[model samples]
Target: MADDFADVYARLRTIMLEAAPAMTINRDEAGALELRMPGIDPKTKQPGWFGTVTTKKSYVAFHLMPLYTAPDLADDISPALAKRKQGKTCFNFKNVDNVLFEELSALARRCAAT
Candidate 1:
């Protein structure tokens, strides 16, 4: 089970990294991966959030903050990916879905540009 989650996390993390090459890596480890725009937010005094892939107990989470700020990005989401969404910005998964991951990769690229 843990191995499955690790594989899922790895694949999702790769999509994020490949899609958003300009973003800064906030965390990269077995349990979590985060990417952020390269600057501090005046309001929060922290880097602007871009996305994250995190391993939770039951599943992994892929979060794209741009989806929250730029609703248009959601327009590109497929129903398959939509079923995994837990919130405006977060998608949870128990296993890897290559089709969904490809869609997610495209979304991340668009998000990175915004």
Candidate 2:
């Protein structure tokens, strides 16, 4: 692991946690921290998936489920931010400096607000 990888993970995880205070959090079997929020399942009327955040080998990933559920808002990602995106919901960060921290924090807040 890189010397600053844990720092990056901590900062990104904190951003996600602050974005959704009502989210339910737990430690995964893989030893990653997980945060989730429940929603109605529409057809079944049961709890549904909302969002999540987890750490991976080289980068920390922020999984914004709302983008999968909504699809449109994701199109607005700026060129600079798009460089970090791994998929529709997965944004990977290898280095977490002040700029990346602020960007991820803002993104988390926006996703949480949806």
Per-prediction TM-score: 0.93, 0.78
lDDT of residue 58 for candidate 1: 96
> What is candidate 2's lDDT per residue for 19-87, written digit by digit as tens?
877767645433156666666667878554555656677677777777787767667667877888877
Per-residue lDDT of candidate 1, residues 20-106 (tens digit): 899999888877898998878899999999999999989999999988989788786888888998879998989878898888888
* Candidate 2: Cα lDDT at 60: 72
CA RMSD per model (angstroms): 1.3, 2.7
Error of 1 at 81 (Å): 1.1
| Best-performing candidate as measured by lDDT | 1
Provide the overall lDDT of each model, using Cα atoms, as 2-decimal numbers: 0.88, 0.69
TM-score of 2: 0.78
Alpha-carbon shift of residue 35 in model 2 (angstroms): 2.1
**What's the true lDDT of residue 114 in model 1?**
88
